[model samples]
Target: MTMYWRAISEDQPGPKWAGLFAEYWPAYLKWWLKEGDEVRASYRESQRMLKRHMPEMLPLYDQLCELAGGGDQAARFLSFYCPPPYLSGCSQALWPGKAPVLVRNYDYNPAAFDSLILRTGWMGRKVMGTSDGLWGLVDGMNDAGLAISLTFGGRRVVGEGFGVPLILRYVLQTCTTTEEAGQVLSRVPTHMSYNVTVVDRNRKYLTAMMAPDRATLITHAAVATNHQENVEWISHARFTATVERERYLLHRMSLHRDTEEKFISNFLKPPLYSTAFSYGFGTLYTAIYRPRKKQMEIRWPGTTWPLSLDSFEEGARQVNLPGAA
Candidate 1:
């Protein structure tokens, strides 16, 4: 399944609207119920944390409830906090805001995948219903020269704190530089497991933060799969495979001593999926976000579709849309 979408806002202030919960509630509800009470409790805790860190998100939550048709189940699901676990195949290229792009090889179904792209805001809030259930992203960008991608890190004992989705949103909203983004992460309490990758305007800095019980900065040139540096924790069989695949890729890339551009290009190559050696359900799609050039591009490898990107800039762009702001 190869697909991508582009959203550009000249006067719209970074997508503060709420329509995703309404759009994918049925899928979300189905997955939420599967998790039972433990997941439900965690979601409630996530809601409380969201209210404290980003009160502005409350309206969106309320909107999601209304969209879910307003009932105890909807309320309960809305209150839950866990982000759907994703097997993301991503590559980043730097054009310094002008040419930043991200390519994503998403693992879920195509229909559900399209819904997520449409519902996500540039700088607002987004919730996606996936095979593993619901997940959130704060902001995502793709321009001429920069791109950013994030994925969850699941471990046994990361105590509850702010939901990873909110943190993703915060990064999209406030920071432009890797340094600035790192600073924001430093201040937050990341109680869950996550790996956030940032590719700046120049495409020179590619950094990952593996936040388990606490956030740890990773300086390695490349990271794949799940385990963080020096941390020992057993994960599910599927995740273990995913991590192993990443390690293999990282090692293979290291052998070449490639530049960032070459590294990303190599990483984006289509996976070979077979019953014996699966590439984790085949990557659904890939997207690139460029900051400096204020543009974004997306491609679908399976279908060989055209790459797409949307552009944006500072003072010239409106911070809020007509009624949504």
Candidate 2:
């Protein structure tokens, strides 16, 4: 399967951030409704569900509704189609408790990558109301050498709250450490289930935060596949169980002991459930952010496309001060 990959590093802060819904609401609504009025009705139901669950995010809700040209269209779409227990899949990993990573292979469609990216960036700018750009990060590494990755927990039951995608964006924009990130997660209620794996530069420490209805933090040598072990509670078993399967694969690949390159080689394979999940265009992408080295590498495993920070102004233009790493 083909994939689109990008890695960016900035010495100084970039432009103001934007909201993701600004660009996505219209296109997404139109696309989902193309099937007919029944589909449209279902979409409306979803939006209503979202509003009821996340009343605190009313400002964002209002912005999205306005962007979609008002009425309950945006609210309905979100309630019925977007939240957890409804939209059943995603995956992620984190590095050093700071760098956050994520991979989402939707059951919806495989060809939606290009449109998703364009619309995400557009909506990010518009909805976030930032001058910068729209981006729901697949993965992000922080200045502290803390990295994070995400994966969807395909469970039958999930707490009704804000979507994990938005939570992730909020974490990347605001938090700097595992503790800080965890606090953010604990405070915000999530609509769906997900596993967040965190890693540090030393690679000596790794943790996974599992959110079933609430958040639970766990300590392990490494976490693979779908299940996330946290302190407070263990999430119910997932229907897909990809994480369990991936755990075996990771063991065979020696991922816990291997170098980053080797680990990534086995980690980003095509999805096993091809019928339910598509593996084209956006299924797999990898990013390596080494804060200690003060550099980052973004790779498209399927396409073999690799890009380094040296190529961009955010990386090249800035002088690497001594001890910056």
Candidate 3:
């Protein structure tokens, strides 16, 4: 299958964003209403949650909601409050090299994934990364020298909280350092289990094990794969190879003492590089973030698409991944 990926830059929410929302809203609405709209949060509760937790993003939220056509279902979905449960496979690590670099592979089913990279200057802050839910980020960096990414926590419990992607979006929008990101991650309620890893330009990094039912665990771990401190979901851990991936990353952190280039190359092959699209865990793209320089790049096996906070260009590519079809 060939996925048509796009990179778009919008200094503020406007026509470009509206067009995207228009194009994506139908499918999103179907997914949001999949379990029935009655099961999702009401528009009132969704708005209230947004105002209470991420007040700073309310303005941008309103803009995106309006662009999504001012419908109740659209508004609620954009809020990302108590939405349906979702999961993905991913691996993230902070390089122990001289310069601070955060790299990860976003493992997900391409059919359900948003093949869009968005660069935005909303609320006077420059932020960009792989966009999900139209307004949320799967992984992204800011001009503040903070970068972040996520992986599934390999658990099945779901609770009442914002989706993890929106939490990631909020961190990039409001926080400037690893400390601030940690605070947000620790506080925000998530409906499912997620392992969020963040790194700053100072080379300081931390991973937050966040779930809806328990207090978030803040750790100094440099590597994060699909499970948390323990393998709570044994079958998931085995299928995704979460333990093996974590060990591989940890092993590289100690033994692969070489150029950052070589370190990144490891992610392009197994067992880190996954081709399990048939199982909804294929490695869609690998992201490399240099918070110190405010730059990011997306990598496939033999392709590279680079962008920066300072200068971003709009373009598209056709990506063919095995088993995605």
Name the candidate that leads on lDDT.
3
- The sequence of per-residue lDDT tens digits that candidate 2 reaches over residues 1-325 is 3332222332322221123455445665665466654634454455564455444444554554555455565555544334323333333333213333222233223334321211122212211100111234434444455555556554445555555655555554555566666666666656566665555455533444545555555555344444554222234233344555565554544535544455455435544222333322123234444544434444333333222322332211111111111
Top candidate on TM-score is: 3
Cα lDDT for residue 215, candidate 2: 59
Q: Model 1 scores what on Cα lDDT?
A: 0.45
Instruction: Estimate, for each residue in 79-115, the C-alpha lDDT of model 3 and write its tens digit.
Output: 9999898888899998889899999999987878889
Q: Of the pair 2 and 3, which is ahead by lDDT?
A: 3
Tens digit per residue, CA lDDT, model 1, 142-224: 33233456554535555545555556555655555667666666656565655666666765455565564565675534343
Tell me the RMSD of model 3 versus the true structure.
0.9
- lDDT on C-alpha atoms for all candidate structures: 0.45, 0.42, 0.92
Higher-TM-score candidate of 1 and 3: 3
TM-score of each: 0.64, 0.57, 0.98
Candidates ranked, most accurate by TM-score first: 3, 1, 2
Query: Which whole-number lDDT from 0 to 100 does residue 193 have in model 1?
Result: 56
Clash pairs (backbone) in predicted model 3: none
Error of 3 at 158 (Å): 0.1
